[model samples]
Target: MKITNVEFVISAVRPDQYPVDALPEFALAGRSNVGKSSLINRMINRKGLARTSAQPGKTQQLNYYRVNDQVYLVDFPGYGYAKVSKVQRQQFGQMIETFLNDREPLRMVLLIIDIRHEPSKDDILMYDWLKHYEIPVCVVTTKADKIPRSKWDKHVKMIKTSLGFHPADRHVLFSSETGLGRDELWALINTTIEEAKAEAAEAHEAEEAEETAEVSLEK
Candidate 1:
């Protein structure tokens, strides 16, 4: 997607603060330092749209971005920051859960993880939670340029297996610095939007049909 316009909509600590416009949203989820902010900047063709840091857990709220006046791209706070205090960690968990479970405009989630290490326990749980909700997900293995080309397949397999990801849900080896997997992700987002549109249409038709039946029975 060519982002013609980009703007910060809000930092939503509460769900009510989310953008009221009915635009499809693609969210990025991951552990701290998983390169999500960098990925968003790369996607939007902006230098610092999402912000970066050597410090982990900088994003504590749902960051919203309006793209090309068509759709919303959300940068969710990464979950597994080691240095976070217990109280802060718990608060982060609540925020994440509220956005995932209650937010209806979310179309798909891109779960980011480091390519060099095994998927952490928090990563596994995040994946499982999305699964339980039947949410469509695309796993992104970041910092792929750090590894040799020969070792790419091996690391991808390790991540999939560690997270118990099925063949149906594949992982993309992403490099924000190199723009790896950018086209593939765009295609995925397009497909998700089409699917969501079809579902919404079907639901609207179903509701109309029920109303018609009620009217005829009352006559």
Candidate 2:
């Protein structure tokens, strides 16, 4: 994908506020301060399109970033922030759950996790939840630059083991600082988009054929 137009679409808290264009959407999920913003910035080749904050729990809604008008990167509010109010956390949970469960255009979730440490309980739970719902997910272990290159495999293994990582889902080791995994991630996203389009076309053709058969029977 060439580096081209990018737009900050909207910060949506409810389904009604979501974009109506029906572009394929990829949700970014992780704990607060887990480098979701930085990953987005690196992926888009933008210095600061997605705002990064030192403060935890700063993002409270679904932030939509339209890339080349081909897809939307939906940024979910970071979970497991202790400082955030319990009620607020519940609200965030409900918001995310509703979107994930009902959103038709959502393609896959890029679940970000810091590669320097073991996957947290929250991380494990989130992964499990996504799997339970049969939602497509790509676990993105971010901040790979912080870890030494020689021990990358060791850390990745630990994270995978701790999460009981599913074989079918993707696990990408990413470094926002070094641009590691950027091309690979983009390739995965593009492939998914194309697959979705193909599936939709097939479904449309099937429906048209069924309609034609019904019309012939009536005639």
Candidate 3:
């Protein structure tokens, strides 16, 4: 996670447009105006790499950003924007669901929420979907700088309660403005990638062992 080359790869609306590099990707998901772009920018140490839009639901595509040429941060379209038409929202949901369910390179997802408020209905639904899929996730509560330190624990508890967050799931308090939890988030991402690789390796070994046993029996 050293600071190096950061590039805006593509705005992909379909899997065909997704990057073919096979790099492990961390998908960022959250409601509109929840600071997903700002968190990406902060992680890359860039001021405006990920554009912070004043308009909610402005990003209708999966914006892929390559960090250090190693991992891609896939920013999904922010949900819960009231101005969007029902049809458009349905389309977005299908697009997101397809990626979450089918994307092979997706290692984990970072679901962002505001620290000062209870988790919205949209947030809870997203969390539930991820859990149902057994997708690796890290819940990021942003805007921690706006809240006082003493009350941070209280808000975190409220968020966990509202989302019914699993105790095993990782939760990081973040502040894009202050760089809080940036390092921790990066560490968590790297750890997730490593764990996924280990799991895949174990599965491959098991498959090979099974094949060997079958061959021996045939012999």
Candidate 4:
């Protein structure tokens, strides 16, 4: 996907602040300083569209970025950081839970993790929560270039094992610094978006058929 028009739209903390355009939204979720911002920059081919911060957990809201006016890449606040207050953490958690549970435009979520380490407890829990919601997910392990090419499989295996990776879930090894797996991630996002649209269309058609049948019976 050649991205041309990518722009930071809004930083929304409340549900009412979310974009009304209803574009398919792909969310990025991960622990603090796990390079979620860098992954977004690399994916969009922009240097600073998603700000990389030295202070983890600086993002306290759902940041929405519009791509080609076709979809929105939502950069969620990084979780599991210690610097934030308990109240702040709780607020972030509630915001994220609400969006994931109720948002209609959300198409897929990309759970980012570090390639060099085993998936953290938070990572595992996040993955489980998404699965429980039956939301489509694509696990993205970033900083892949830090690891040796020969050992990539071993690290990926460890992550999968620790997370109890479901067969239906997708996983991709990524390197934000080197643009690795960027194209593949985009492809997955596009495919997920199309599939969601198709499902919605089919449901609409079914409803229409039922309504028509009822109308004929009444007549």
Candidate 5:
């Protein structure tokens, strides 16, 4: 995707406040301080559009960023922050679950993980939950620049093994500092959006056909 117009749309805590444009949305989920903000900046070729905070669990709502007026990058509240209160964590969980289960425009989720560490228990749980729900997901390993190129494959393998990564899901090794996986991630996003559009179209055709059949029988 070419670099173009991007805007910070909203920080929404409720479904009623979400963007109504119905653009294809790719949600980003990760542990606190996992370089998700940096990844978003790198993806859109911006320096600080998605604000990076030194504090963990700073993002408490779904942050919406509209890209090229064509699609959305929805940033979920960072999970697995030990410092966050139990009530807050539970609230975040409910908010995320609702969106994942009911949001119609969601195309895919980019589950961000730090490449330097093994997948956390929270990471494994989130991945499994997405799998159980049959939601499309792409595992994005961030901060790749911290690891030597030689060790990249080994670390990736370890992470995948820990998470029991799905065979059909995509994984992108990313370095927000170097823009290593930006293009590949965008390609995956574009492909997913197209697939969703096709599915919707097919469903619409099937619905119309059924309606027409009922009309004919009534006549």
Candidate 6:
């Protein structure tokens, strides 16, 4: 799919109101101020496509962006904000859990983390929660422009080991400023959508077979 067009659609808080189209969705997730919005803007080659700010916790809702009129790029609120009250944080946690568990249309999550620092506690928890839910994820290390090229491997390995990522999961280095890892991320997104669709089709076929067997037994 050619990414000829991209536009912001809405910021939704509830799953009942999410877009009902059959288009595949890739959601961007990360801690507060991890440059998640900036990365989305860079990938789509549009400035301000996703509003960016130095302030953490700016994106409070699930922001949806349609690309080429075929796929969606969802931006989720950031986690691990120190300033947010405990009750608000708990509410946010529940909101995210509901979304991840219920949004079957979501194909994969592009989990963004800063490359300069070690994975925080919230990061680890997020990783584990996704794995538990069986939602496919690709961890993207943002702000690569700040790190030296020679030290990239060392940092990547550190993040990988800390998160206990499996052999199949992918980890990519990204930079919103210099446009690094853009193509790689897009390719992963496309593959993820295809894999999810294939699995769904297989499940549908199996259900049909089971229904046919029941019909034969009735006759």
lDDT of 2 at 135: 96
Model 3 agreement with the true structure over 1-219: per-residue lDDT tens digits = 688899999999989999999999999999998999999999999999999999999999999999888899999999999999999999999999999999999998999999999988999999999999999889999999998999999999999999999999999999999999999999998888798889999999999999999999999
| Cα RMSDs, all models | 1.3, 0.8, 1.2, 0.9, 1.0, 1.7
lDDT of 6 by residue, 1-219 (tens): 356899899899888779998799888889999998898888888898899988888778899999988789999889999987788788788888898888868888888989989999989999988998888889999999998999998888899889998888888899999989998998888887778779899999999999999999999
Cand. 1 TM to true fold? 0.95
Per-residue lDDT tens digits of candidate 1, residues 49-151? Answer: 7889889889988889888887888888878777888898998889888888888899888999999999999999999999999988899999999999899
Deviation of model 5 at 164, angstroms: 0.6
Which sections of candidate 5 miss by over 4 Å?
Answer: none
Which has the higher lDDT value, candidate number 2 or candidate number 5?
5
The per-residue C-alpha lDDT of model 1 at residue 94 equals 94
Per-model TM-score versus the true fold: 0.95, 0.98, 0.96, 0.97, 0.97, 0.92
Residue pairs in collision within model 6:
none
On residues 108-173, what C-alpha lDDT tens digit does candidate 4 reach at each position?
899999989999999999999999999889999999999899999999999999999999889988
Regions of candidate 3 where Cα sits further than 4 Å from its true position: none
TM-score order of candidates, top first: 2, 4, 5, 3, 1, 6
Q: lDDT values of the candidates? A: 0.88, 0.95, 0.95, 0.94, 0.95, 0.88
Compared with the true structure, model 3 gives a TM-score of: 0.96
Question: lDDT tens string, model 2, 91-189?
Answer: 999999999999999999999999998888899999999999999999999988997999999999999999999899998999999999999999999
